[model samples]
Target: MQADSDPVTSGMIRRLLRLVLGSKGYDLPFKSDTDRNFLLLLVALMSFLAVLACAGTLTLHAMTQRWSSGLENKITIEVKAETPNGEILSPESVKLDTEKIAGMLEGNLAIKSYQVMNEVEIKKLVSPWIGEDFSFDEIPMPGLIAVELSAATPETLETLTQKVLSVAPSARIETHREWLQDILRFVKTLQGLAFLVAMIVVVTTITAISSGVRSRMAIYRNQVEILHLIGAPDPYIARQFQWHAVIVSLLGSVIGTAAGLAVATLIFHLSGKDETALIPEIGLNYGQIAAFIILPLLACLISGTTARFTVLRTLSQMP
Candidate 1:
């Protein structure tokens, strides 16, 4: 029983080694495993760039969503009118109009809370942009309401807008929807750019990998010629080169991706506590990180396959 168990354990150990480290079939002219290591380095660099490209796009989307949602529950009401003589309206009449509009809005069910901004509040907002001295008293400014909407149906802003219009025909409703739409448009453009960047990275990476494998094969021409003379099949020779490229690519991808995540983490930590910048920092979040890990393996597989085909096709055409 002990003898049998020893053989079985040895066999299991051998299988495990092969699975993790790959089979050492041929010792090439290049220093021990240099070819595979270089392939991996190439893969890692390209994949790292790919992750950077992906992160940029995702962060932009997250930031846009955050901003849009932040303003999702708030709206502004402005009250203003042109005088009949094509001049600015009287402040007293505007104030009166603002009161009537506020009173009407206060009775609405969709409104969660309402605050009528006095001259002071309006001036406070305008101070930074224009100047502190800017006042509603000096300039015929519109009366504004800072409105918070009910959680159930914030989109029903149209109904509330109509109600305000009924009370004061000249009243204006600015729900931030247009601004949100503009933000969304900007986000969409960013997403488009991200997609384009991702595509370019993939194409460039694939090309780099294919070229590297081809170059490595060219160096191994003499060995391949000897193997062919010794009656080794084309498939066998292809398999060795393919496996070497695959191993290298796989290892490189793993290293590059890990570095990418680490850099993202460092940036996230250094973002300062402002919290207002709202940068969409990177995190794995379980399945998300796993997806990135899987990508490297896929890249390796693709690179290996390309190398295999390129070598076999080239060999087939030769005498």
Candidate 2:
């Protein structure tokens, strides 16, 4: 049995077995390590950015839904400066009108609760735009009331609007539906932009991998041709490049994803501390965290596939 088993044939079988077992037995003797390191760095950066973008999109979507739901059943009633007689109402008259409207809202079955904002509260609301030192007595500020409804419908809203106008003809009723629609549109637009950016990142990553594979193939042209002459199959050669790409991309993406998670965690903690932050409580849920963890595997798959296809295509075009 030992005599029949030729040493050269046994060595070939061992190499093939190693290849099948996912070992890098066919690495070329070229200095491609730097190229691979560069590829890893680029992929890592792209992956990090992609994760942040996805997280932002998801957070914005959640925020939009929460805001929309909260405001859906609420309306704002603005008591204007002018009364029904087209004459400017005094502060006392505006106060009386506000009281009268509050009484009407209390009697209405549609209204769940209503609050006539006091002058101090209105001043606080305008303090951001107009200086706190600005006297409200010198200017006419509309009396504002926030109303919550048990059931907000067209008929209920119309009846409420008419009652408010009768009590204070200059009063304007505003439902949040239109504002919510605008906000939803804006959020969707941002999501679309984020998706576009992600697609660009994916395409750029594939292109980078393909280019690196092509360059490496060029460097190993002589060895590859000798392998082809010796009956080595295209898939075996491609697997060498594919596995390299996979290893490099996986390492880079993992590093990148870790960095991204760190950033997201920091932001979540910081933003949570400040209730007035633009993205308060910006953090991934369990499902989103799972998706984020899958990013590295996806990057590896993409790079491996790109490298294999690029090597095969380049070899096919060779004489």
Candidate 3:
């Protein structure tokens, strides 16, 4: 229990109590002070937790979009022609086939973008495997045309692939269904894990806030006892404790939100690494960034309201 008359302790508690309930705001006969320490601590905790959750969710959403955007309606076609030796093909034939495939793709409404690989580009591609001395002029290097379709069905891709193969007998279309499926599954799993983490943090935070309030209220047992002796109403006493709890939680929320947003900003900043690396979309979108701004306030509201109800319930049995 807190001492009734230690000069420093008395002053601190009085100041805290006043800050919480506000001086002259209530006419309660008992001490009406705010616990500023508790309030600040709670706000910090809430802010961090809220930001962590929001950032995680936003990141997951962005990553999903990235993966989907990459795979959506895209296919690659490989073209090859048999040489006199029958073991290799000519580079010119490969280029011609690629151009023909590109022309075929152009007529279809579903085909949004098509890039035909030429002899020089194909030579460069094969240089990694064949070395610089290898002449793609004499031997056929497989030509590839990267095609992006505009919201086409899987059947449409199949039909397009057949048509291309019929016209360019040496060309083969490779559908990316398996790879796309794997990417989708992975994105979904990441999203689910992020959500689970958020739920766990929220539950842990609520428990911490409740326990802290209970602990602080325990130290006021003597004051509460005096108030009871003087016939103070339970509501009046409960109001003081409730107010204290709300203020404490509000503090934790503020702290938590700040920490969370800072971490998110750092992640966003660091995402500008290698150009070729599959970096997740780390920057916050318009809606998500807006949500982050309000997340701290929402946490304060939730924790404060929850604490008030919890304290009142606990105080209901008091005489």
Winning candidate number (TM-score): 2
- Alpha-carbon local distance difference test for all models: 0.71, 0.81, 0.67
The TM-score obtained by model 3 is: 0.76
TM-score per candidate: 0.75, 0.82, 0.76
* 125-177: candidate 3 lDDT, tens digit per residue: 77867777876555556878888888758788778878897778777777677
Of the candidates numbered 2 and 3, which has the greater TM-score value? 2
| lDDT by residue (tens digit), candidate 2, 120-204 | 9999888878879877678778889999999888998998888898888788998978867987899999999989988998999
Q: On a 0 to 100 scale, what is the lDDT of residue 263 in model 3?
A: 85
Instruction: List clashing residue pairs in candidate 1.
Output: 40-248
Model number with the top lDDT: 2
- Quote the lDDT for 251 in model 2: 75
Give the candidate order by descending lDDT.
Answer: 2, 1, 3
> Candidate 1's residue-wise lDDT over 1-319, tens digit each?
1122333323443343357546743434433334455565677887787776666676666677677777788888888745545578888988999999888877678888889998888887777678986556678878888888875254586677778888887888787778679878978887898788778767776677677657776887888888888887888777766666666666677788888777765665677444655354434345555667776877777877887887788679757
